[model samples]
Target: MSQPKKTFNDLKKDIIDNQICTSCGTCEAVCPVNAIELKNTIPNLIGNCIECGICYANCPSASFDADDMDQKVFGRTRKPIEKLTGIYQKAYQAKTTQEDIHSKAQDGGVVTALLTQFLNEGGDAVIVADLEEDKIWVPKPKVAKTREEVIKAAGTKYTPSPALVGVKQAVKIEKLEKIAVVGTTCQMRGLSLATDGPLKNKKIADAVALKIGLFCMETFNYDDYMQYLKDNDVDPGQVTKFEIKNGRFYAWNGEERLHRAKLANVKPLIRSTCSHCTDFTSEYSDISVGNVGSPAGHSTVIVRNEKGQKILDAAIKSGLIEAILIEDFDKEETLVHKLAEMKKSSHQ
Candidate 1:
């Protein structure tokens, strides 16, 4: 059974004392009703919260607040593992016709399809990254609803963003009940921390109904990406699609012309923090989704929790997705291959 939902005041206390409030003003930006304010790097609830739980749900620092457990395995829990195993046991791969969505998406249309399923299932909202000022280079994380909004936020961020910056506020304002988060492996690690440890808060963890983690090779800094575009004589503004596939950097603009470059040519351009990261797949998340081992335009999904499995199963039943059996992914081998490929491509 689910824990009893907390009131707005209960959530506010958790934020003031427990969570890391990063004064990003994300809660202020996404709140449908002006109920929160940022003061001295902390959110101040100004108006009466509607008990929607949006603020609590979106808080990145909010803890899991269950039984005490090892800090190292915060978000990496048994629940997700059981779910993942179940999915893998029944796993199958198939091609999807949702080409338009797939074309604009970061990997396959799997992320979009999952997000759509959540929205259709009475989910309050989805937390994702968006252009801070309508510029591709400037990403500002935000929670959204409409298909257009999610699409606009689509594509790989390739940067270490404060994507979980708003989670605390969502819980405080009570504006969200069930939220689905799309984040990378590092972000999922942080979420795991929040879900475990003494700082764990029940209100926030319960609010985060789902987490969708993306497979990350590494994230690039915004400045580096812009510089790479300039050096390649490619205008970042004209580029409509950018992807790293088979250890190659693929970019395209308005015309059908495609520019394929080796991944090695771009390694020096990545963020310093990404190199130290070892978890390419977010083991802590409810579901890990990416295109690591799948064919071009196909997503490899690892359902990590019963909640995640239930959602995916429902989507399949609804005909929103198709499943097929494929070779089980050996995580260690896959990582080694990815690293080797990146190394080889970088040398090219």
Candidate 2:
């Protein structure tokens, strides 16, 4: 029997309605016509559908084979060295050498330092999550071409920003030649699909030069996050920083702690799609960074491929960043694997 034909409506039912849409905006970005738009952080069809199936094909929530896509992009798949962490050449506990970056960065300033070095050395553009003008806490994704702009975009926003949307804007609107994309797991998965899927778009494929993925357990719903803060009598404007660590969500105003909630208390605000995602380490990205296994002021770095290694080496050699071998890579890998399993079992 022939397989059933796919369409945009199928994507709406299987993904959007199922509450598993990552909202990476690939549908809106790759649509032949202006048919898809993000409404309240969900992709909605606003125009006619040609039943071309691009939306369904590109949606990360629908799933794709990681090894197949890896082969297409890099000429081979990552070596199966570990089950949860995928393939990687090295692991390190690293931080920026620059004191100013360490002071302003979210964690260890590694990502901010790396991006600055990459751009200073002729990298074209980078997509990052930055604050939306007039909306202090909300993140709006943008392509930053300068070191200053990249630095300004530092720090993490617990809410999803769909950085691939910025990738779309960069390649099409800005006519950028090469781009580095920094995003969460799902967002990088969308990029992997775009670059190597059967219906790959060459423009999107050629435009991306590097992919940096973040370690994420889940992202929050913007409305729910704001409501949670308001219900607790906390003001968003005064929140100098937000972080998840040691089973708690912390909101700080400079040196003052404004609010502290158990991670369990905040689980209700998590985006539903995150529960179905198993990639806690961004398996498809060139490099992945997070604070899970490192000290309070350090970051865990996974160098996944040669390209990632090259950039990392240059950064270390130039004194842009410093590195130390993780005390026990296996112990940290175990921790990451446990979380990956938790997310995977949620759907079962």
Task: Report the lDDT of model 2 for residue 154.
Answer: 88
* Candidate 2 pairs with clashing backbones: none
CA lDDT, candidate 1, residue 105: 77
| Per-model lDDT | 0.61, 0.83
Measured with C-alpha atoms, the lDDT of residue 145 in candidate 2 is 89
Lowest lDDT sum, 10 consecutive residues, model 1, at 81-90
TM-score, structure 2 vs. true: 0.94
- Stretches of model 2 off by over 4 angstroms after superposition: 1-4, 73-81, 330-334
Best by lDDT: 2
Tens-digit lDDT string for candidate 1 (1-348): 997655446656765554434333444443446687665435678887887665555443443322233224433434442322222222334333466666677666777777777888988778787766766655656677777777778777565555555565455454577788777765665565454433444555677888877767777767778888888888767766778887798777744545779989988877654544445555566777777667776787776557778877877777777766455443424542454345335531
Write candidate 2's Cα lDDT for 1-348 as tens digits.
976657789988899899989878877777777688886578888999988888778888885777776676557666544556767778888999988788777888888888887887788889999898898688988899887788888888999897878888998778898889888989988988887787766798898888899998899999899999999999999987899998899998877999998999999999888877878888788888988877887888988889888888999999999999765665534566677666667643
Candidate 1 backbone clash number: 27
Per-model root-mean-square deviation over C-alphas:
8.5, 2.0
Tell me how candidate 2 scores on lDDT.
0.83
